[model samples]
Target: MHPLNDIFVQSAAIFLELATSEFMRYILAAAGLHLLLSTLLKPLVRRRKIRPAWPPKGQVRREILASIRSVLVFSMLSLGAVWAVKAGWTQVYREADAHGWFYFGISVLVLIVGHDTWFYWVHRLLHDKRLYQGWHHLHHRSFNPTPFTAFAFNTGEAFLHGLFTPLLILVLPVSYLALFVFSVHMIVRNTVGHCGVELFPATRGGRPLLGWLTTVTHHDLHHASPGWNYGLYFTFWDRLMKTEHPDYLKHFSAAVRAEPMKRAKPVALSIAIAASVFCAAVLSGSGRAEATETAALETISGRWVTEGYGAVVRLQPCDKAPMELCGRLDWIWDPASGSYLGMEMLSGFRLQGAEWRDGEITIPGKNQVFRSTIKVLDHNTLKVRGCALVVCRKQTWRRLESLPHIGLR
Candidate 1:
């Protein structure tokens, strides 16, 4: 067989394995949680008569169909993960001790936090008027969601959501077990958020400590009113941005107050199990940290389009100094205006903590350099900011796999 054919065959096999496994995981998680909460638990826990019945009329069937479509789309996207793992582009490790138990816990936390951040931004983006009708309107169809609505996403929306996992794995070192745990955590939280009942206790002003955490009511409000409550796992972004629904507290209080006191044992047991798992993850043994070459710079190497789509820059390793980062203008929207192609745009960047700072970016039209910082929002997005004294300009650039045809405007 040809070398390319051999590689293709191997990738196909990996994709099949990953897709099948992921599909099963989605079905089991969504279905099992739905059955447990909507069918079994809700009936047992009701203390008083609620105005609206659970599951609502006709919502379950729509949710089921939509979720099935989402599963297929997600399964297809899992191929990207398989390719990354096989090509050694991902930081996935088979050995649990490769990065130590402590690092494993940290990695899991990072994945969750990273995922929440990504979801919040992307979710908000999808709500944009230009994108909402095509990308996100299908999801809002389920005004009163059941558990099945947890995974019910439009194909475009599904692809965006599915892309997060593969992108995260590419940039971060994660173990197989840690990824599995993250998957479980994702599904459980997703199911509870859409479960249509408040499983958390009511607090005075929603409890200061728990306020940062999203509850079932938080996402439920998002469905009820699409503009507010755009968080998936954490409420930090919504709270900070003041996008949370105004009546969120009143709704949460009503839901919590309705829970029957007689069924407290089951809810308590569930919380206890979750707490134990968290404790175990944190208190696990520490091992020797792995000493490996940092690929932090390589993770950000790619072609990026400027925010206004004004210019395209290709980022690569500096030839003269391998440790330094450099970018050159590859294309300009208006070539007749003054071709900047091959002109250096970025240089002198080094990794500083979570961001790549102490860099300089040349202003395209004006022959001037300004202090700049670059941070990888994800595998396909870079946040670049340039500061000139008190005046600053920021742009979120999207990665391009290949350069496009540039013509004079």
Candidate 2:
């Protein structure tokens, strides 16, 4: 046999052995957690399931199969990292002490933060319509993902996912121990995020500490909604980009309290009561029926066309508690923009003086939310203002008795 052929054979054998080991390691890590969280620990927190219904029949099975395929892809991609390491191209080191104890710890931190930033941007790019249908859509097919879905990725997506660690190794002097820790942390968090249960406890008011970490509800919403909550380990990117589902905090709070569906009843009831009171106040032409604030909030309710005729938004009570006020995108001028339709646009507005204050308004197309307030200028007009940091913008929306014809624009 030719010497080159023998070398080729030896390399192929090594690659297959490494791939098998990685595959088993991933399978065990994922499946072990799945057993603990989704099975063994499930009955203890059965009430905390993010979605009421069990995943569709065979969903977990499909996710497992896809995950296996992705693992193979990941393993194949691992060869590149192995080659880089052997060639002394990567900064990976064998001894943890080479970086000292503190730098060793810091390297782990760097890998996590860097991986998060890398994941956020790559994950967002995967959601592009062009990439989504062919690539990301495979993973998304498990709309209600399981722990197995942690590794489920399209072939291209697995390739992209696998590149992160290799690239990190090339750029940073990551110890093998740090790399191992990073890999372990990655699988554990990835599975937990996709575990279809909200495992994180909610902080008080759902705005501190645990709030910064991504909850199972956060990633579950990403599966259910497909267009929001793209973060993996933390809420930083999603919050900064304003791509977080408006109800994320509410959902997390409900999950932690094990009162997921129960919270909806009061919101629905409050909306009905508010509407009835407003109508009565208007008909009686008296302040006796409802508070002036209630009347104003009621008047703000209805479909209104955005400035420049961009879209129609319907204002109503948010499904979350306090039920102050919220808005949903009802219609858009472009049919292609229909995905933005029905998305929450405003949330948590409450009457303060003549304006509804302390509201959040999401900008169409930009996927950004800003501090907002709205006021009714007349029966037919509303003044809406939003601020990010110190920059503020205001727009007027005309009340729409009915939706304008899509062709009219």
Highest-scoring model, lDDT: 2
My TM-score estimates for the predictions, one after another, are 0.61, 0.61
Residue runs of model 1 more than 4 Å from their true location after superposition: 1-9, 38-40, 43-45, 48-51, 56-58, 204-209, 258-267, 270-409
Q: Give me the displacement of residue 250 in model 2, in angstroms.
A: 0.6
Q: How accurate is candidate 1 locally (lDDT)?
A: 0.72
Clashes of 2: 0
lDDT of 2 by residue, 1-409 (tens): 3434433543565567556656665566556655555444555346567777767888877877887788778777777787687678999876677869999999999999888888899999999998998889999988878877888899899888888998888889988769877876787678778877665544445432366888788899899898898888888988899999998877776665633345535433543443343233223322331366566667778888988888888888666533378889988888878888898888878664466765689887886777776878888888887777656678998887643564432
- For residue 83, give model 2's deviation from the true position in Å: 1.3
- Model 1 poorest 10 in a row by lDDT: 284-293
TM-score of 2: 0.61
